[model samples]
Target: MKKNLLYVTFVNLVNGFAGIAFIPLALKSLGTEGYGLYSIFVILVSYIYFVEMGVAKYFTRTIAQASNVSEEQKIMRSATGMYIRITLLLFIITPILFFIIPKWVFPTNNHGLVSIIVIFASLDYLLSIPPTIKLTYNLGKEEFEHISKFNLISGLSKHLFLIGSVLIFKSVILLIITVLLRRVFDILYAKKFLKSMPKGSWQPQYAKGEFKKIFSQSIVLSMAQLTQITILSIGTFLINRNFTMKEVGIYKATFDLASKVSFFSNSLGMVVFPRFSSVLKRTEEKISLLNKMPLYYKISWLVYSILFLISLVIIPIIPNILNIQDMELFYLLLYGACLNAHANLSYEFLQADARLKEVIIPSIITLLMMSVIFYLTLDYYSFYAIGISWVLSQVFNSMCMDTMVLRKIRKSSSITTICFNLIISIGVIILYLSLGVY
Candidate 1:
């Protein structure tokens, strides 16, 4: 477990550099309008997780519970066939949506090109799923080092290709092709790794009642995932639709920087999930988990504090480094990130306990609130309203998760503490807005 945590942490650290570098290169090469279209394309790809129906997560939990080599192989074989069907279905449906949806959502003049790019990108993402099945299997088996090693290769290749393609071609078509080619390489490496593992069949077959059972369980998780994605992307979507692509570029740039912190939390969550699943059935082990909860929470706060401090120092330099004009959005986004950090730790625990409802229910509520608030304020405030709505929604979500988490763990959390945090968050936002500090 310790080794897996270390490996995943290292992978996130390496991936962070790529993430930081890729944004400026993409923005410089594509320009604002082109980058805005690219942002929509990426958001569309992110939504593909909705189509995935949480089957990848189901694979992790199912395979983790396997008793022996034979059982594990059988689980993998069944999962691979199921995943293939899902991928094929997505490949077909996504392109059709791309054809129909872009016309209504984007400027009519650019619809044709955007549709073509979205189709290609969707196909590329679908093709990447076969390799994902293998990677998820390794995760279930606790082969963290192996997963991290391959991820480094694939991660570096993806960014390098993105940077090279954007620098040379400055074409969205070529940028997506770069992604497709990276997936092709990843597929080859994944297949080679599988061949060296305990043998698993790839012959597609539908097992009796198993698909129904898995889908039933997975759908809840899928919904939770969808809500989470909406929370993350709603601001981007609203900005793109209501404002200029140049404004969208600024918003997404700030978001990308803030998301680096989330990348670390998610990496740690991935490590925790399967390990927690392993001991979930044992009562004594579950108690042990509770006992260590404080330690985990402490560590999480420590990490968040370090990240928050670093952001304070780094955000001012970002505008100069990337040659961006606006740094106001960074203040809003960084505050949102700090608010989310504590809630994310709570989310990880609930997810491990299969209590996904707690995390996602608040997300659904916050989404509705954000949408309404952004709409009501759009005429008067424009993009600035989106920033305020985002921070307010984060506070709402943090309160919901923090309260539920404390109750579940039998930990005492006073109303004074929650109210104090809320007051502080609101006060800080007020200060920023009143002073126009950002």
Candidate 2:
């Protein structure tokens, strides 16, 4: 486990660096307005995530729960078939979205560029569905090190091509082109990997039945996931409406840095989620595993805190280089990530047991809180206010989800765990006030 964990963590670190590497070059070459334009497109592309609608999460847990490789393979095939159908549905919807999204997200003057970008981006998202299902299969099987290496190769290749495009083409159109090519390559790679696996018989009847079962669970999970994605991306959308593209660029820069902290939590969470699903029927094992989660929660907070401090030291030295701000914004994002890790884990824990509806209300409330707060505060407050509201909404949602998760597991809350959380909360508050957070 430690070996795999280290490899996965290293891969995540590489992925994070690869992501951040684009910003400086982009800022320098494209300038704030150009980058902001690109950022809006990127955010718009991310809405495809909402369209994905928790299908991958459902696939991962279901595949992980399969009794054997043959069962896992069948699940994979069924998921692929279901995704093919979903893609076909998107084929009808996507054209309309391409027309509508550009008009909604960008200025009317740049409709041509935005329209082209949305079409390509939407195509990229569709092409990615197959490869993502394969990747989820690997994760469900706990092929951590193998998946990590594959991701490293894919990530490096994509970023290297992107960096070259920055120098040679320096066009957002080319950037979207790179995205389309990368998705094609990823799908080919995933197909090659799946072909190497032992073939399992997948009857059309069985595949149809499996799709229905998975789709039923996915409908609920999709709503929950949509809420989560909305909470994360609402800032960009709101900022685009009320602020300048330059301010949008600035806000996105902060959001990106903060999102890197989330990479740490997700790196571990990805590994643990399948394991939780694997042990769902065994109460003793599940309890034992749940008992160990607080340590991980604490570790997530600790790592994020250290990263926050490092950003303080590093951002000032090269403030203009990466478009980094001072510490307050980072702290807000870090705090949000810390609060969110446990809730995210809880969501996985409950989902592992096939409790899809348990989190629906909390998820809805989270979306509402983030939307209301961000909309109300965007005019009166700085971008950091958006960050703060994000953290607060996450806190409320996390508490609600955590309560349900604990009750479902038949575990009483521990005082020590509660104390650790309070300590972290108080410490963050002090740190925020000291930094003159507004």
Candidate 3:
């Protein structure tokens, strides 16, 4: 396990660095108007995570089970094909439906080629297939290390292009071109994993029944996922709706800088899920190991909180970097790290056992809380309050999810465990806020 974490950790660290550059470059190059269009497009597709219907998470679970039952390849190949077909079918139909967002969502004032540049940037979302194969392999072989590695390479490559484009075209077109190119790379890299797949593995024989089973669960899971994505992105979505695109650009850029802390620390949870599922079946070690989940999560929180705080101080030195104020940007930075870790903690403890059913109770409660808070506050407070409220909701959800998960796995949440969580939580919060307050 330690061996596995080493490689995955390295990959995640690098990818985290790269994603940092990627978001900032997009905001800076595209400017505020470009960011507005991009934000709407991202938010729109988040609604379509419902289209994935939860099959991606489904694949993560079933792939491992299918491997245990018969390693020679079973439902997943056809399942992959089916998943892709459905996603593509939905993608094709997307153009026909109403965009849900207001038509006047984008600012009227824009220079030449704004529509073309922004539209191309949006097109990449359509071409991104459901990622069934990559996910399936990941669960089947516990391939998160590889997953992290590829992501690291791709993420770094993306930053390189982003930095280069800022020097070259220095316009929204550069952002558009970079995004489209990245999609092309995403597909090709995903395809590389496809080569190892069995011949004629993806026949339609296993599609209907199994896909439906996974799809049904995915409906609920997708709601949680979409809500989660919306929470992560809702700030920008609201910013675009209420203000001009340029303002959206600065907000997205600042948020992007905040988001890297999330992407980096997230590797721990990302790698832990499959490992947890594999270990759960061993009744001998089950209690002892399951007890470790919260500890690991808190330990990760402590380490990442400190590291991200340092990064927060390091990045915001440039006053006009994102065209937004440093103080509010700092708040978003803190929220991004803390909320991101908390959000991932829900998935780790709740769904790590492959029981999609677990997410229902907590997700329902969190979803409602988030919706109510956002509704009441968004119109009045704009981006900063939006970030604060969202983080508060995640804190609530993470506590609930952690309480349930600890009790279920450990049978008794010991004093030691309780004390550990208290110390970690209090410390992480204190130090994190100190960075912002200073």
Judged by TM-score, which candidate is best? 1
Per-residue C-alpha lDDT of model 3 across residues 14-131, encoded as one tens digit per residue: 7776656566566566666666665555555556546667666656655655544344256556566666667566657554443322444343455224345334533655556534
Model 3 is weakest, by summed lDDT over 10 consecutive residues, at 98-107
- Residues 372-413, candidate 2: write the lDDT tens digits: 888777667766667868888877876676666555433445
The TM-scores, one per candidate, come to 0.91, 0.89, 0.81
Q: How should the candidates be ordered by lDDT, best one leading?
A: 1, 2, 3
lDDT of 1 by residue, 1-438 (tens): 778888888887798888788888888888877777777777877786578798887778877788898887787787877787787788678767876757665543477777886677677777778787887788788888888887777788888988999999998777877888888989877766432445744655578987788789888888887888888898887886787778887788778776677767767777877887787768899877765665555555556655665555666655567544356767677777777766776676676678877777788999998888888888887777887788788889877876665564544533544555566566655655675555
lDDT of 3 at 262: 64
The predicted structure with the larger TM-score, 1 or 2, is 1
Q: What value of lDDT does candidate 1 attain over all alpha carbons?
A: 0.75
Model 3, which residues run further than 4 Å from truth?
67-72, 102-126, 130-132, 171-174, 191-195, 206-208, 308-325, 354-361, 364-383, 409-438
Name the regions of candidate 1 deviating beyond 4 angstroms. 105-108, 192-197, 317-319, 411-437
RMSD of each: 2.7, 2.9, 4.1
What is the overall TM-score of model 2 with all chains considered together? 0.89
Q: What lDDT score goes with residue 236 in model 1?
A: 80
lDDT of 3: 0.61
User: For candidate 1, what is the TM-score?
Assistant: 0.91
